[model samples]
Target chain A: MVRMTSFIAGLSLLAVLLATGTPVQAQQYPPVGGRQFPLNQMSPPGTAAQWAINAGRVAPNYLQPVRVTLPQDGKVTFYESLERPVELAAPAQAALLVGRMYRLKVTGMEDFPGVEFFPSIELIDRLHPPQGREEDFPIDFEFTTEEFEWAANGRLITKVIYLEQPDRVPTELLERTPRITTIEPSRNVLAEADDLGRPMAIVRLGGRTPDPHRPEPSFFGPGGPIRLPAKVTQASAQQRPDAVNSR
Target chain B: MKYYFLALGTVVVVCVGCAMDGNQHLNKGEYHAPPAAMMGRPGPMVDGPGPGVLPMMGGMGGPGMGAPMGPGGMPFGAPPQRPAAPSTTQIRFVGPDGMQIGWLIPNGYAENQLVAPARYNFFQGGTYRLKINNIPGRDSLTLYPTLQVYPGHPNTEAYLTHNSVPLQLTEEDIEQVESNNFVTKVIYLPDARYQELAIANVETLVSTRLDPGVDPIQEADKRGTIMAVLRMGNMDLEMPGQTGKPMAGTEQGGIDQVAYSVDGAQNQFMPPLPIGPAGQGTPGIPGAMMVAGSGMPGAPISGVNMAAWGMPITGTPIGLNGPPHLPLGGPATLQSHTVRNRSKNEIPAGVKDMLIDVKHDPGYRLPPPVSYIQYTEKHPVYSPGELSMPAWAQGQQGQGQYCPPQQQQ
Candidate 1:
């Protein structure tokens, strides 16, 4: 009788296990059109969507979904994959003018799975002179698309579009400041950066950029202030951070 | 008792089914979301065209629809799609008898990863050669077909050569091209994490005073011009051992150089570029820059000169006879090492004041003061394979230098 009872109890346990199925949660979102990205593990679909929105590639004003082809130099990479750097297309490069905004359609992404493509817009106004490192700009917002379609070749095509915005460039970006020049007596300056971030003036004293491997010139060392050109007074200049701010 | 046995059997059967389901999930390995959660089109029109408004993709050049065509049309929103970006395709150069000669990744593909089937990103509609495998000694000489990916080529497949022609390169030509005439692609990451690591590595390599060897992965030639430096996947970090298996072969530690195989087909139609020393021209023997140690005047190694001889030039050595071999004075290396180091260090009080002084001072044209100096050594007079000197003439190669007796003190 005990054995019968044990068997009955085991049967009940088996029924419960089968009813619950596996412990793994079922996938919440089924892939569009029943096809998932081949290398989906590397880049989540939602992340790609966000990149599209931020880049202004997917926007509301998009009349129709226009596919923006990645140019020869443009790079498409996955999240956290820092080793990859891609170039921009000439047309894409041109569209990045300051005060001008654009909306692009995300397409052809289905072909390259596990890769996320982000367009890097120059932070400085396109019309302004290029700044080496200080041209501070932020990336566009991330977005998602409403449509999904497959090309004739069975590649999934993204149908997201970014909206365009009015040009809101700062006046300072368009207005150029006159270069400055200052001359003083005690310590002379060779070059300087004006308050407006332009090169104020450069006094070429015939000194080459300082080399650190060799011993410091007798006048300048770890002991004191750097040697300045003689017969010069209080000078104000900005040097490209050759030592600390550059690679 | 009979009921107990039956129950246990039933439980075992259910457990087995559950295990199978678990295995299925693992095998699929893809994260999926339901269709309802996706970003569907917005309800109200926010800007430009209204929501669900589809413009004519056809012939009409409507005002807001088609926009302009030539150059500046469609400044924003729904610009015409250009050709797709070309992608890197994994290819194995198969010999006539089907032997695996070498693996080829496009110029920008991640090279450090172990050989696997992957589609790398490249420029669309660009033409390039599939040569220049990065093996230490065995540079495949057999010519492969030049690949020109079509503008709309699908990125889903690997690049395969349907037709290939072999060229008869004189051993000297091979030597020249291998040393100097090849193209270089740099791997760069804009992320701060990578930047920190790169800065740290550069600092450690520079400040340690213990002459660290060139980075095995990303190498910057003495010109400060960087070629490919692949550091991405674990597969790239750990190369398969000599037996052609990871960690299983006799040769286990140290660097595992890539292998190359040259078999059939060389494209004779396309002329090789002139990459040898300038003035010497194409196919000409490169002018060798020989440095004799103070003690060992005659014995010098051919290609090993780059790492061994230490001159104060600011770039890494690019081997003998390689292109970009800066003749005694090529301009300073492109990177500013001092600036990189400065960015890593905290500003001292006096230095901060000096910066303010410069910013305020008008005539400071020479830029900021550099903290240190970097120098690249000269190349050897002869190419490695082209070296005709006697064995004793070969100087010691690699990181350790062949210092002159006088300089040794």
Candidate 2:
């Protein structure tokens, strides 16, 4: 009787083993796509959604606040439209649209006399500061003297600005000046920045200037709308700028 | 007891069946041979003439002698070590001021010119013999060196395009060369992790500076990507002949020829001919060509055969020189050639009958795509008297708009 009971127990154990293995075998058949990007291990750029926005599939952020800080006193001009050119002093504050590329002209640099630089800013993503305090936490676009010298020497300077992820970085007081890390040309700067934090914008400075005689309309791009802070607008009004700022 | 044993055996068999079912989808096909070119070993044509044919040849030693014959009784060695495509790499010659740099052409050496901190564009994946003369201190001494520009690799492409390879002959290198010692210098771009400084710069590895038996080429390769290699020796390549002239292009003298020129008008650069019996043409030999296959009918065998009367065999030759000693056997004579494919079939039979039923589990869930976002906040109402608006803000809304209405959505 005992032997017969053991046989029954063995058959029951086999049944349990067979039942447990079926689900695992079934799950192995199909493979799921990974959530993270394989090359950079970062989320895809927001610019990728431009096509969807154009097709009326998604909404875009308009007038994202961006602050341009030059090394020395300089004039920053933004072509709001072919007919409208808004000029402001250095440390200029403007709200640009996300997923859009804008061309800005810098002149009257105290250090670099008589030299003009046409730099481009591509906002891939936006910041989410507390409501009504967007002006305080504007995306910083700092230009150094070294970068200007490199641009003047015909070398293209590409800088990627990213917001620091508090958890990933060491806990310390943030430096007053923006941290600049120059890497090899062959390295993917976007990927490197993404590894450290969330990438927000890409700034490219080159020695190319616009031809006055036969100006290329594409050089100015599709003049996007820009918004100046109340203080900046008041200061510009005091100076009596060339282009009138409209609401 | 027998009943209990029977039940246990049945359970064991069922458990084995369940385990096998887990691995049933795995592919268990026969391994197939890869392509001949992918094997990485040299092919038959690369072995050149067998060992005894050219005993005195420098690089043609070892494997050329007694290496096992491949199919069709042909000797095979390692695969051709040539780069994929021809690319021009700018090489900057730095240091040793007043040094004259010249390179060997097809027939003789090109004119030497003073080069210090000068740059020249040279085609990569080639080994050129250079004539170094008029050294600053050692004015009477001359050196014949070989510069081998390695094929550009993906790792070094960016560095080569933006920066030139700096080739500086140091004082130690000159001293070693003057003492009748051979020196090899390898220029390489060190990898990021191997670099000690923040800036990326090219590093050089000299054979004389390294420990004995340590190859500079291998060391450089381990550190980074090699751009070019310069090997120098004290051999005099332009010795005088019995006729009181330079031995180049003379019978029973030097074998150098002017195969290429810096100025294209003199002689267009051609890829060096392959070494061995399978090569199309021999270098330094006036009009000598090597044919590997039997000649086709009606085609001349090295310009020796002619079409017969009423039976013309008209077709392109199989090899460059056609058949060796050819004559018309007959117009209708049968010629046979066989081509065998050595590749194997990796796929197993009855694979079409296998069923693949892959589907996502119903329990798995993914977050829905973002469709809408709304921001609602209260703004302070400003009285016209309290807040002064600028002219631009009054004319517009104080906001510059460039995008279309649809994009604003």
Per-candidate DockQ values are 0.04, 0.05
Docking class of 2: incorrect
Quote model 1's iRMS: 22.8
lDDT of 1 by residue, B154-198 (tens): 111101111111112223433444454332122211111222321
lDDT score at residue B291, model 2, on the 0-100 scale: 27
TM-score of 1: 0.22
Candidate 2 reaches a DockQ of 0.05
Worst 10 residues of 2 chain B by lDDT: B54-63
Model 2, position B402, has a per-residue lDDT of 43
| lDDT (C-alpha) at residue B5 in model 1 | 69
lDDT of 2 by residue, A4-38 (tens): 75868677676856655555422211121322121
